[model samples]
Target: MSTERDRDPAGRARNARPRDALGRPLPYGAVGEERAPEGVVRPPDRALAEAQELLDAGRPFHAHEVLEDAWKSAPESERQLWRGLAQLAVGLTHAARGNSRGAATLLERGAGNIAPYAAEPPHGIGVAALRTWARGLASAAAAGRALDLRPPRLRA
Candidate 1:
């Protein structure tokens, strides 16, 4: 087998390794869950809906990838909101993977990132609600308590 890294059209190396639902890499040639495509830009509405679907399917890792794409491709004014959403999704992934401390930190950080937008949220993103959810989950994670792991609503 060629030991070459997979390359996208632009020649950036992409990990061709298969990943589990939580985004953990599996052994070579192992069949794994389908991954979200990298670097595809989506409008806020479409991105939120797609991420929500992945979250509901218990694929926070995939959700994070979608949100990360949004964050990377969004205009400067919208970067924080997308970043926060991505962080929350990754927080969920950490929690699912049993990294409680990491999960807690990320959840809290995500909440803080989105807090500024609470007063005038854009694209109908539920900033206040998401902040609440992130905080609650953060506390549970910090306490090493079990997480109920409900997906957050992306929009009001």
Candidate 2:
């Protein structure tokens, strides 16, 4: 057997997925195949812009799809930020569909995931707004208050 340091330690571990060049977990290429593409990120800027556009259009589910691939291509540490944004987008989608409870749950999970960025969030979805929305939902839930799940009005 190869030494722990010399061998692929992660390969021997159970439930361990392979990583890409940037150490980000790549999605399974197929049902049971796990492989990274020859390239890391296809088009980070385009992906980000599309995601932003979806968000601006109040289409969180669509935005989530736009960002998933880019997030997978990012480094491991960056994944959380992207994942959090995706989750938040998902929550927003559910809210738009009139699923307040579902939205609250997803938003809470997203806030938890992005807690590290609470002080300084990324460009599009920052931690501050996420936290605020999460807290509002939590309070509404606890107090049996009705919530308006509409997205905030964007200033022109």
TM-score of each: 0.94, 0.59
Please report the TM-score between candidate 2 and the true structure: 0.59
Which one wins on TM-score? 1
Q: 36-104, model 1: which lDDT tens digit per residue?
A: 988898988899999999999999999999999999999999899899999999999999999999999
The window of 10 residues in a row where model 2 has the poorest summed lDDT is: 30-39
Instruction: Residues 12-95, candidate 2: write the lDDT tens digits.
Output: 443334433222344444133233232246465566666666667656666666556667886787788777766766777766
Stretches of candidate 1 above 4 Å error?
Answer: 1-4, 9-11
Whole-model lDDT, model 1:
0.93
lDDT of 2: 0.59
Clashing pairs in 2: none
